[model samples]
Each structure stands twice: as structure tokens, then as C-alpha cells.
Target: MAHASTAAAEDSCPLLLGKNKLPRHREADTSEGRVVERIADFQGPGGIIDLVYSAVFTRGIEKVKQECLLEAGELPLVPRNFDCWLCSTELLSLLMRGSALGNVGAHTAEGSPNTTWDGHNTIGLLSKSEKDKGVPIADALKNPLTPVWILHGGDHFTVAWCSAATPAEPGSKFLLHHWNGLPPGGPRLADLEITAIKGAISHGTSPSKFYKPEPGEIEEVVQADPDDKTDFPGQYRKWRYEVMLAFDRPDLQGEQRPVDALPEPKFQQEDPRYQRPGAWRCCLCYDRRFKTMDFSLVPADSPDWCQKCSRSRKECGWSLWIPFAELPPKRQAWCMSQYAKKIEPLLWTKWPEAEILEVSGRELPDC
Candidate 1:
């Protein structure tokens, strides 16, 4: 990632690596509006760097949500139930509507002096945007003009994070679980929205942030119980159990116990190998010992995402994921049935659209 101050502190572009080194798609190669563009110099919080890094590198939403609280201490806010980051919306769009990055790499002038990666196909996404929604108001195939948009950008990639729990229904298993009252159809472009964000740097990724892994290191780094889900970062699992316990004891909108009073996690894992930058593994998919890969080092076009997650149209992202695909068919159905249970109250108060998942949570007070 480039200097946060340089990218977000000011409006001027901070030409990154291939900013000027690569040739711009000649004006002769494009039309107007087809090369749609929106730029913002964010000035909100400084925690966005880590946030975007996680999403672009394909970190699952569950882990991103955990990091929001544990890492940033709620600085970025855990993207309320329905909302999501502008960067996530952008990357999701690229994955869903835009041409695959592999099909969109740049063409060098024969052997124009270049290093490893020159044709910059990166994208700069503000964390917040009021005007970014649209199934696909625009895409790269139509707009090949500038390699980098504005100065805000990150290594372009995709991600998904899903989970499931035991079903509540007696039968009717073997089907995927979807949000209650969720449209049987796909999400419209309008759902993504168009909004402006502050306190975010568009260029939020760098090569140094990624580290290549040694052979067999991937499997060794991923520790599975081969039973229940893997444990959270040391002490976190126990801490989370306590948090839920605290929440359940409180009455509607009542003052809960002080978080500081909560007990520290009883267990912690301290493996130096897994702590390295880009030593990322799919925490959502533990059934199979998937190979771990460095997200930052890989080319923009191809991501080593889990085949199962990819098949589920995971590009929709975490907030937007409707039916949980990570779980087995029967398991996914059971979880959805739970969400469907006792959801009558929320539909009248909230967006109602995204409130289905909350039914599985504590009873929300009517506002």
C-alpha cells in the first residue's frame, strides 16, 4: 500500500509502480462513459489499510468481522448486518459482472522495457461510497483507458466467507440455506449502491505485504481438529463464548456488562509460521486440507480460492452472501431453517431484506 496520507490526505494522484511506466489505453481505443470512473480522497479512520488488505486477499467475512473488533477495536465498525465496504462492493462487481482479470491484462509495446509486472490492472476502491451501487454501471472490458483509476488502488482480487450450523427442521434437508424472504432471483446491480467514503486510501496493497510459503508449510500452518470447526486465535473462542453469554443475560437494549470485565481467552495458539504476512489459509473451509497460497504475490487474473466457494458465486461477498455455501447441503438447509424461525418481528422494523439472518440471533427490539 502507498502512503495513507499521500493517497487519502490529499486529492492529487500518487502515481504507483506502473502509474506512468505503462502506456495508457490510447484514446483511440475507447469511448466515453464506457470508461466510467469515480474518485475520492478519503479522510476517515486509519484502520482501512488492514480492512482492504483482508478483503482483497480473499479473507472470509467471518475473519474480517473478527479482525474488525479484535484488530481495529471497532474502528471500521463490523459493517452492520446488511452494509459492506465500498472496496468489497467494487471487487464483487469485478468478479460478478466485469471480465475476468486474466482476460484483461495489458499489451506492452512489443518489448517496451519492463520488469515482472508492468501493465497495472489494479483498482482503487474507497471504503465508503454513496454512489457505487449498480449491478454493473461500468466494467474493464468497455473501459480500457487508464490502467489505474485515479491514484487509489489495490492489488485486484476476489473473496468469500460463509458458514452453516445444525438445521432446525425435522426433514427437508439436503438443500442450501438462504436468507429469509430472500428473492429467489439474483441480486440486482442497484443492491451494490453508490456512495462516497472518507478516511480510506485507495492504494491499500503492496508486494512486501505478501510472503511466499515454503513447501509443506501450507498444510503444516493449517491445524485442524478433524472434528468441530478449528479454534479461533488463542483465547478468542473462549472470549467469544463469554461475549454471547453476556449478550443473552442482558434485557432488551439494557446496559450489558463491561467488556473489560470479561475473562481472557483460556487457549491461545502461537505458531510463528502462521503469523507471517500472507500466510493466509481458508479458515471457512476446513473439511479438506486445502493448499495455502500467498494472495499478494499471485497474479491479478487467477486467485487460488477454494473451488467450493467459487462454485457458489462467492463474488457476492460476505455481507451479500445469501445462502451459506460452505456447509454441507443438509447442514446449510438446517441453518437456513433456523434463520427462518421466529423472524416475524424484524421484518417490520429493519431493512427487512437483510434481517433474515438476524432471526437466528437474539430477538431484536422494535425501533
Candidate 2:
């Protein structure tokens, strides 16, 4: 990942790489408005840089522009000689019709980048307009040429144009993403009278400040039996028992006490040889006397095994695992059923009894 503030410090054309880079031709190449040219001089007052950025864009809705201008009235200003930046590509998604969060990346020479679908993408680089929502309106409208519009009732603002090549096409619309400042306004943009624009904005707040109930909110304490083999003892015993009871298994019918819970797993840790990152053998599949390692170069820590053996290294001096793909259907079914049956008695102590019954494969008679 590139460090923040690097582009403007050392490069000539901060928008695009290289010296004398021409204004981007494809409107799609820019964020909100395509930044065509930028000239900065470090000779300004006390060596502070004086920068002027030239942006170009296709025309857009007058109503939207007006709304944005009105909202812009509330934003604050950037200190002199400082460049405050915003990009449309980052802000456009937030300004769409619904509160639906759209996925858009920054203005890379090659459009927004493809992203991973694993749901971890949270970093965002926004256009100056989007950031303007946090400050006063006057501060948000630093650009002189681009048009501005306001959604009348309040601080909501939208830029006049999206950019030249990627210009807001005829009938193209923007989201009220944010306001840098109250664009010479009164109520916030969310209070604007624009038709069908209500309830679309959400007041921002910190999630860490929100309240959450303590864990096991409804459980009660229960004493453990003296003969119980489970390691759990005393005061916290009931919570363990409740969890054991809540274990969902189709073949199990009654409540499972802590003892009936699955035993703490015993990992193979004693032998340094098999303890390598990818080495592991299932206790139920092999018959060797000295644990033969599966030499497939599989990561020793992988959860899957190549083969199954019927004995464990500790108990029978050998360990094995049937390759997962080759396991007989009947054996796999039997293992699943056995696992389910083992946990059956522990179902439903904390959850509603109805849920427990559904999981236990026991249909209740109609009332």
C-alpha cells in the first residue's frame, strides 16, 4: 500500500505519474471532476506552496447543483497555501440514490481496481466535497469554476460537474454523500425539501460508544456433581452446563450435562518429527508402529488429511488418516452421526425448547 501524502511531495504532476502529464482524456480517468492541470510554487509566503488545480467536467442537473451550492454554505475553509484534496470516484458511490453503499475505487489510470469479495475492504480516499461535509460550507467550495447546487432545506451540496470525460451524462445523478461545510445554509442538507430525499441520510456516530448486553445474559448458576469428570467446577459451572445443553445435534434427544460435552481436544504435540507445520495423522486411520508422516508436502497444519488409519500414534504407536476424498460415504456418514449423537443430550437448555426439538429430529405432536 502506498503511504499517505507521498504523491504531492516529490512528483511534478501529482494527478498522473511523470513530468508534464497532460490532462486526462477519458472522463472515466478522474474522480468527481477530472483534475486536468495543477501548478504549485514553493516561493509563496514563507516558502509555503501556492497551488492552483484546474478541473474540467461535463454539465449536470441545475437542481442538484443548486442544492450542492446551498449546502456548501456550511463548510469551513482550508488554510492559505495548503492543498486540500477530494476525488469524485471515492465520493460518487456515497451520493447515489439509496443509502446503499456502492463500491468504487480511486481514480487509477486504469479505472477503479477490482477488489476482493471477502468483505474486509474498508479504506476509502474521498473527494474534497465528501470531506467537506464535516466542515463549514464556505470551506467546502474552494474551487471557483465548477458549478454548485443545493438541495434547498439544508446543508446538502453536490458538485456542479462530475468531470469532463467521465462527466455526469445527461440525467446522471449524484448522492448527497456529505457536506464539507454548511454551504451558506441554515438546517443541514438532510432537512432539505427535495422530493423523495427524506430518511436517506444517517447521522454519524461512533459504534464503540453503543451499548451491548453482557454475555450469557439470561443464564443462571448451577452446581456441578462431585462425580462429574468435567474439569469445570463451582460458580461458573452452570454457564458451561448451559453451553453443553445448547449444543445442537440431530441425533441427540435429551439435555447434555457438562460431562457429556465433547472432551477437550488432544492435539499431537509430543513428537517433534510429526509436530512440523504440515504434519498430522488422524488417530482413527493408520496401523503403523511409528507414525508414518504423509510425505505429500502438505502443510503440517492443514486441517484435511490424505488418508485415514484406524489407530492413534499415542495409543497404538502409529497414526493415519483416510484421504478425505477417498473416504467411503458410509464411513463419513457414520462419523457424522456418531458426532451428532454424542452431543444430542446437551441441546436446548438456554435456547427455546422448540429450537432444541427441531435439532433433535423429534417432531412434537400438534397442539
Candidate 3:
């Protein structure tokens, strides 16, 4: 009798259907009278501006508020005076099923209509949890059809997609695209190498090899800017985390090796500043001009010096040059405090076992 009652309850459930009896929820109504009507008016490829506007006006605002309360234990109240920055979860939802007209069916690991890559959320790729699952940064670059979104400094969002660089060799590079809402033009595009993207994820710094501009490039880029758009060559250096989208394709294989091993940073030991057991040295020339600048004259409070380099203060310019070991405790405390809010959370969450104490005390590990 108990078994018969259980079967009856399952049969009556609205989600169960067909001979297979698979569980499936009903799709949100996208009829003529709803938000879909407004979204339908937009034609062609819409960028982040389009995505955000459609999402907020439709239902994303309420959805994000509920999710924030459930996950973070606080409501994200939007101020009437300024625009609110949406989190990765809310942004992913807007791309996935936020609107009938703009819907790309983009799938994510943490948001509603949850989809997993290899049984884990794709967003995990940006965090320490990615050690176990999700698509590898290498494989994502190889496949041209895949789209990737990157979250930086917990505040900004950028999109990337693979495209053929030339007819001779298809899928040669990935285009780093950004949407400028202020100018009212199309998305701006830039070329990004696969190796550089991998390196940035592994090491915390943007590899200089990828972002270093060629001669005359900076001048040409400066003249073309509208002031609202970011400085082209410099923006690549600020990335913090990335997420791979699983929309329209699910069969892509994820990397099995540890996330840190994707590509060991080639330049970690090139400069002494990044090294442990830091020593006092001229900031301008590293060790090249150590004899020219006297460290003994520098005050304990203001370690920074101007016109210290006797050779040419005009040529060398004014820059604070102090070794990691010689930095005053107060300055050291200030440096640590800045990282506390944004970078510390990433360190603790992604690498729980890491010794995150000051560089003076903690031993440098192989990253």
C-alpha cells in the first residue's frame, strides 16, 4: 500500500512526464504581453550593454536579490543614485535564459538552470575548487566555438571567443572583446594568444610577453580612443578570474592536471622584487644603479627618494624603489590591507593550504 501511494504522488508531480518519467520543469512564459516583447525589438549581436539592460528590466534584479540573500546572507539593495554592478551569477543568468529574444541558453555551474561541466560548475575554474573539475583553459582556447567570460577584481566583466585569425590556419587566436555602452557603437575587439591567457590564470600577473606593445602602437592607440573606452594595451594586465560557458556545446573535455601546472610562470624569478629574502636595491634599475642611490640616506618613514640617483634624476624619473624586506612595517601593513578585501579572499578560498603571511616571514612556494 505504501509503494502504491509513493507511485501515485510521483505521477501527480507536474515536472514528471512521458513514458520515461523524467523530471523537467516548465519553461518560463515568453508570450506577447511579457518582457520578451521588449527584448524582441533588439536585432543583431548584442554586447554586455544590451545583456545588462535586458536582464535588469526583465526579472534579473529580483532574481539576483534572492540569490544574494540565500548565498551571502545579505540583500544587495540598489541605490537610486548610481548603477549597481552585477555579480557573475546574475550575469550568467542574463546570458542563459533571462529573455526569450536575447536568450543564448548559456549554461553556468552556480546560477539558475544550473548546468555542470564534468559534474562541476564551470565558474569553479576561476577558484581553487577548479583543481578537481571544469574545462581547462587550454582546451577552451583550442575550440573556436566556445565562449568564455572573465571576472576581474570582483568588479568588472569581459568576454572572449575563439575565432580564426586567418584562412591559412583556422582557430589561431581568441578575440578579447569588450562592450562600450557610452559611445553607442559595436563591441571593440583585440587579439589574445592562448598561451598568455593560460599563463595569467596560473601566475597572478599578466605576462609581459603578451601585453608589451610594439613601437608606435601606443601612439596609434591613443589617437583612436574616445576616452570612455579602456586603454587597449593596458586592460589585459588587470584580469583576476575566468569562467568557461557551456552553452550549445557540452562534450568538450576538461583538463585533468592541477590548475597551477597549466603553464608555470616563465618570469617568476626574473626580478628580485617577486623573490623572497628581498634585499635593498634601487627601484629604477633593480641592481644596475645600486651604487648611485644611497639607501642609508632614505628615512625610515619615507623610503621613497626623489633625485637620489646622481646620474640623472631627470632621466631616471621619480619612482619609489624599496625592496620587499626593507619596506617599513607601516607600509607593509598598508600593502597587506589593500589585498585583504579583494585578493586575500581569492588566496584563502582557492589555496587554503597556502602560507599567506608577509613575504618576509613566509617561504616562497613554486607557483
**Best prediction by TM-score:** 3
Provide the lowest-lDDT 10-residue window in model 3: 215-224
Q: Name the runs in model 3 displaced over 4 angstroms.
A: 1-36, 40-64, 77-145, 164-187, 196-367
lDDT (Cα, tens digit) per residue for candidate 3, span 1-367: 1011222323445454465654421222222223345544454364445545645555546665665454333433322223654445434433433321211122233433322222222222222212212222222222222333332323333343334321212222233332222222223333322222111232122112222222111101001112212533222112121111111213434433354533321221123443222222233343234554533322334333433454332233222223323333333333333333332323322222222332233221111
Pairs clashing in candidate 3? none
Question: What are the Cα lDDT values of the candidates?
Answer: 0.24, 0.24, 0.30
Residue lDDT tens for model 1, 1-367? 2211221212223243244533432331221112122112222355354435433344345544454343113423223343534333333322322211211111222522211122222331121111111111122321212321221112212111113321223221221122211132212111111111121111212112112222111211122222222443221112111000011112234233355643222111223322323212233333232353332222223334445445321221111111133222322323332333222111111111122222234322111
* Per-residue accuracy of model 2 over 192-267 as CA lDDT, tens digit each: 1111211111122111221121221211111222333144322121211111101122543434335554333222
- By TM-score, how accurate is candidate 1? 0.17
Stretches > 4 Å off in candidate 2: 1-73, 76-123, 126-367
- Per-candidate TM-scores read 0.17, 0.15, 0.31
Pick by TM-score: 1 or 3, better one: 3
TM-score of 3: 0.31
